[model samples]
Target: MTRTTHDTHPVQGPEDVSGEATTSRWQQVRATGDAGLATAEYAVATVAAVGFAGLLIAILKSDEVRELLLGIIRGALSVG
Candidate 1:
């Protein structure tokens, strides 16, 4: 005995009716085009955040900024 298989929706070519083949191809591309978009965005945001944190750290470590912070702390701590 032998079994036969058939495809209910066969692949469409450019010659398909009403440009459906082009539309279908575009839909498929669009569907999968952004599969990693969110991950890529998160990675970019993470990198930007890390860069900003590094900048903040550098600024805070400056002598002038350190002195200003210390002065502010001293003023806050001193009794009037």
Candidate 2:
């Protein structure tokens, strides 16, 4: 198989293509589907973060696991 210089590169650009339709950035941002989606995504993410934080606080405050880890770490760090 053989390749030519023309096949490897394109000289024409978007500006060279005339009369092609384009969408403005503000128009895309104003779409009905765009606005609500970000807020909905953010709400779900915020709820997950809060739930995870609550679970972590519960573990830190509990008696058995926290105490066990602390004792192990302290023993490993102890100097003779």
Root-mean-square deviation of every model: 10.4, 11.6
- For 1-80, candidate 1 gives per-residue lDDT tens digits of 22223232345544465666668757866765544458779999999999999999999999999999999999999999
Go through the candidates in order and give each one's C-alpha lDDT. 0.73, 0.63
Best by TM-score: 1
Provide the lowest-lDDT 10-residue window in model 2: 1-10
TM-score of each: 0.54, 0.49
TM-score of 1: 0.54
lDDT of 2: 0.63
Score candidate 1 by lDDT.
0.73
Estimate, for each residue in 1-80, the C-alpha lDDT of model 2 and write its tens digit.
22233533333445544433234323433553332348779899999999999999989889897899899999999996
